[model samples]
Target chain A: MDIRRLRYFVAVAEARSVGKAAERLRMAQPPLSVQIRKLESEIGAPLFRRGTRGMDLTEAGQALLARASEALALAADGIEAARAVAAGSRGRLSVGYMFVLANAMLPRLIPELRRSIPGVDLDFAELSASTREARLLDRSVTVALCMPAIHHPEIQVARIGAQPFMLAMPIRSPFARLGSVPMARLQGRPLIALPPPERDPSSSAVAALLRRHQIVMPIASRVETVHSAMSLVLAGEGFGILPACARLGAPRGIVFRPLRDATDSIDIAVCWRRDSHSPLIRTFLKCAEKAVAPL
Target chain B: MDIRRLRYFVAVAEARSVGKAAERLRMAQPPLSVQIRKLESEIGAPLFRRGTRGMDLTEAGQALLARASEALALAADGIEAARAVAAGSRGRLSVGYMFVLANAMLPRLIPELRRSIPGVDLDFAELSASTREARLLDRSVTVALCMPAIHHPEIQVARIGAQPFMLAMPIRSPFARLGSVPMARLQGRPLIALPPPERDPSSSAVAALLRRHQIVMPIASRVETVHSAMSLVLAGEGFGILPACARLGAPRGIVFRPLRDATDSIDIAVCWRRDSHSPLIRTFLKCAEKAVAPL
Candidate 1:
């Protein structure tokens, strides 16, 4: 049966009187009775029995009521889900993000997105700047939070926020006593560098900053992520230069100090394919913008 | 936008031409172009650009196309889910059943129901015959499979299958060695009987069968279900009379043999509220009937 008929049936069943049901439904009793009669005939079962008091459900009537209610509820949910999706507040959003950016942005964005679009399913994966671009091109991820260095012709980038570079050192190190370490003080020290400039823009930006200051820092190790660099620094391997966002959840043994002579900072942005248009992606972008605005 | 507009957009996007899209949609190109223009205007963005080769999607066009396609798919799924529920091929069916009969019926019925209604979510709970009636009446369960002794005025019962009385004995018992055991042989022996006749029809039937055969078996204990009786039997407490369905998944330590003098069988039936009209219930009943027909 259609939703209208089911609704009519539920009103009549609940009211147990045609006149009362019609009154509640804002309809005439005769038309309501006719519809109920039509529904009973369609199913070939009498849904109601007239009694001395009023009317009561027959065995088949009770059965129909149970099913009709469920069917109507399911139909309503389906419609709501569809409308929500169309409104860009429902469906799945796969987000690719840098580990450091996620630590800063996700804590605020995830909860706010959940509150705003309770129907949307959020999926996340840790990705470097280059990998995020590849995933965006292939449509593997709906959006990415990374450096604003995307050069792909089909990728669109929107700058969210920027954070200046900071030095991560062992908490007990001599430099930890200083509020900020000068570029000159870091000369000849073992430095933990990020992977090649081709794969990571943050590390490339750091390298350029060091070169601009004419600091001849000896590279002790190269790592793929800020987390790994932090691990190495925790082990007293070398000091690491990372973005300000990376300091959000730094390990207990690590301390973050600003570079005294550094004017360069990492520009963080949200990226998606220029050819892609998903409501989920749009909603996510909006959420990302709102999250970064507060910072 | 509505589903119709989204459908038109998807067709145009896929074909990359208004003419081809019209041909596929079986409409004139002019009207299709008008609709697309209207959609673009509504979104406040240019969705496509006319070029010498063909039409190319603008940045906003790509975005709309992606979201429009997803919204349409979700809407389609919602309709399908609603239709499936109406046809008894979707939704959740919580079934209350006896442990023994479930072993006999579920293995066949569950897969058959899944095949028939792939969208239906099946949930099962083990319950006694009396409990099944209570659950059905309270609407805690959608349907139940148990002994056909439901006396509730509001409950409807449909007999699915019946199983003749079988003698369950420990593997080491002398009766286990026999192909079939006569009622007379077990006279005056300790018998693990099911709970008194009022709550269980199977036990009541067995008691009546013993009275007809003039066998005076002394009861060792009175348990609520065949599974409990089987456990006691396995411990060499006493021989037990149970429906043949109980033998389907009997544990390794127990053996089942037909009772020589017993002709009465326990009638298994599916039950629901007499007034219930649930497609899920109807689908479940149909599945149970098909499952029992083979047996």
Candidate 2:
């Protein structure tokens, strides 16, 4: 039976009098009586017994009462879940970001996003600039945090934060004794860098900054992430240049010093497809903006 | 947005061409294109890039595509679930019965109900005859199997099976050595019976059978269930009279014998409110009929 008929039957069963049920349903008695009769006839059973005082349920009416309520509740829950999904206030949002962004950007952004849009389920994955871009294009991830601002026409990028360059040295290294490292301290010292300019624009920006200082340094090693570069520095392979935020949670063996002649900093941006219509993505971008505002 | 627009958008996104989507949907191309445009405008974003090759998703379109499909699916699941509930093919059916009926009636009936209805979740509760009747009247349980016939006008009773009274005795007792116990042999002997005739119709039927055989026995104790009666017999408190099905799974310490002079058998009926319109109740009744047919 349809929901309306079940509702009518429930009312009649509860009230026990056709007149009283009609009053509770805000309808006239005749139509309500007709509806109950129709329901009984459709099920091929008598639902009620008309007594001098009121009405009493037959056996079948009791069974319908239990099921009808559950069916109505299930239907209502489905509709509400669907509406929540369509509004982008619920369902899963997959996000990709760089490893370094976790400490600086994600700590603040994630909590705020959860508080504001509590219904959205969040999933995170660490990815390089190229992989993040590919995942965004293929719709595997809803948003990404990457470096040096993506310039694709279909990609939208919003500046999250910029951190000044810092010199990372092993605790026992000679440069660790100095409060700050000057650009001319060592003309050919080994320096650990990230991926090349073609794959990572942030690495390209760092290379340009060193050139502007006219400091020549031999490349010691190349790594894909700041965390790996830190590892290399800890092993005394070479000193490294990284964003200032990396110092917030660096291990005890690594010492961070300011680059005295550094004129440029690394830029991090929140990126998504420009055509993304999800309110969840829009909400996340707003949270990202708030997180980086003080940085 | 409504389900129809989301469906249209998913079609266009998947097919990558408005004309192809229209052909797949069995509709005209112009209206489909108009609907997509309307969807884009409503979301305040350009969902597709109109290239010479075909329509390609913009960033927003890709996001919408993921969520739209999930929302549509959720809505459809809700509708289907509700329809199943209304059809009585789904939802829970709580059944109450005495312990003895479990051995004879439940094993055969439960499997058939599951096979026939599939969607209805069957829940069984072992209750005393009085409790079963009370639970049925209060709607705590959907249907019940109990002894004798319920006399209530609002209750529907269907005869499921009849079991001749069997004498239960401890294996070490003298009565256990007899092929069948004569009614006069137990004169003045202690008897463990169910609730008195006033509280239980099954007990009343047993009392009437004893009277017809002219056998007078002193009541040692009264219990609410056949399991409890069997426990008393096992403890050597008294010999008990129980249904024939009780013999099927009786412990090794107890021996069941046919009453030599007993003519009346206990009548077990499946009972429910007569007005219950649930397909679950109807299905269970039919299954009950099949279960008791061989007996």
Candidate 3:
């Protein structure tokens, strides 16, 4: 049966009279009565009979009433759910972040999400230097928080915050007592460095920035993650260069200090697929800006 | 968004050109363009950014495209499912059968149901004499197969089959030698009979029928179900009156012989709530009429 006809049948059944149903529906009684007759013909059953008092339901009418109401209710709910998703007020959003930034970013970012799009469910993933760009493109993650923004033709990046590169060294070292180290004083220093990004060597731009300051550090050891760099520094193997946010939970024996003479800082950026127009991504992009604004 | 508008949008996205999409949709190009513009305006985002390529999707366009297609598909599927339910082709229908009839009825009835309405899920309930009427009224069972036809103002029953009353007794009884037992021989015999229905004792009308022939059965025991009566008769506790169909799967020690002078037989009835208009029930009612026609 057509949804409109079912609506008309329900109205007449509830009112028990076409005149009352027409008054509530704001239409003339004749058309409503005609629709009821049409529905009865469609189902090959008499839905109502004239009793001495008023309209009464036939057995077939009673059964149709229960299912018609259910069908109508389900249609309404389907529309409402679609609308909620289109409005970006309800849906699932997966956020990818470099493990190094999880503690610093999530603590503040989760609160921002709750305050804004509270109905959206959240999933979190840790993207290494290699996987962040691929996950965003493949839609494994809706948005990503990364440092020293990734460069790609199909990815869109927005700068939300920035933090200067810092020097992480053993607390007992003389450089820690210097409080703030000059970029020039780091010449010939043995360093634990993160390797170049898998597909692009450009993010190792930190090495280029250090070169501009006349500093050449031999690699003490190369690691895949910033956390490993901190560990090496804590073990007194070598000093390391890391984004300032890495200090959030650095080992107790490792102390982080500013590279006073270095002008370049790691960018805290949010990235998403260039072709995506998701309202959730748009809403999260705004939250990310606010979450790291003070940095 | 309206389902019609989503249909228009998906066409253009797949065709990648307004003129081509309009040709496929059998509409004029200008109106299609106007509709697309209206959709973009309603969303308050530009869906397309013109490039050397024809009709390229912007970020927002890509997102809306995915969800709009989903909404349209879900709406279509919901309508089809509702039509199937209304047509009695797909849904759940629970059948109630007396334990005694389970052997005689369901074996034949289930095959009929499978052939007629294969998409409908079925559930079976073994209703005792007490629960059949209540379960049907409450819709816990969609239809019930009962004996002697339950008589209630709110229930509708159809007689599909009937069987003569039979005498079940120890195989060594003298009556076993007779081709059939006479009604007069039952007079003053110790009997095992089913208890009266909870709210109505009229089904025990069997006792009243016996009185018409001058048979006064001294109650040897009163049991709750026909199966219980059969058990007592098998143990040689007393003779019991059962429907001829009860001979199916009877214990080895008992023998069933028909009444030669009896005018009454047990009626096999299919019953349902009077107000139900379920097509599944209607289909089952027809199947039941055929399954027991030979009986």
Best by lDDT: 3
Per model, kept true contacts as a fraction are 0.00, 0.00, 0.00
Q: Model 2: per-residue lDDT, tens digit, A1-295?
A: 3456666877988899999999999999999999988877766666687779888875446556655555445444434454465577766788888878788888888899889889888999888855777888877888888766677888998887788889998999988989988988857888898876575543587778778777777889988778889999999888888888887667789999998877678787888888666778778888988988877
Q: RMSD (Cα, Å) of candidate 3?
A: 8.0
- Tens-place lDDT per residue, model 3, B161-256, is 897888999899899988899999988888998876556555465776687787888889999888889899878778988888888858887899
lDDT of 3 by residue, A234-273 (tens): 9988888898989986978889999987868888899988
Query: Which has the higher TM-score value, candidate number 2 or candidate number 3?
Result: 3
Which regions in candidate 1 have their CA more than 4 angstroms from the true location? Answer: A1-295, B15-20, B28-34, B50-55, B84-97, B102-125, B134-144, B148-156, B167-191, B196-203, B211-220, B234-239, B245-260, B272-295
Candidate 2, backbone clash total: 16
Order candidates by DockQ, high to low. Answer: 2, 3, 1
- Among these predictions, the greatest TM-score belongs to 3
Clashes of each: 7, 16, 1
Over B128-235, each residue of candidate 2 has an lDDT whose tens digit, in order, gives: 756666788777788887765566777899887788889999999998889998988888889998876564544587788777777787899988878888989999
lDDT value, residue A282 of candidate 3: 80
Under CAPRI classification, how is model 2 graded? incorrect
Overall lDDT per candidate, in order of appearance = 0.77, 0.78, 0.80
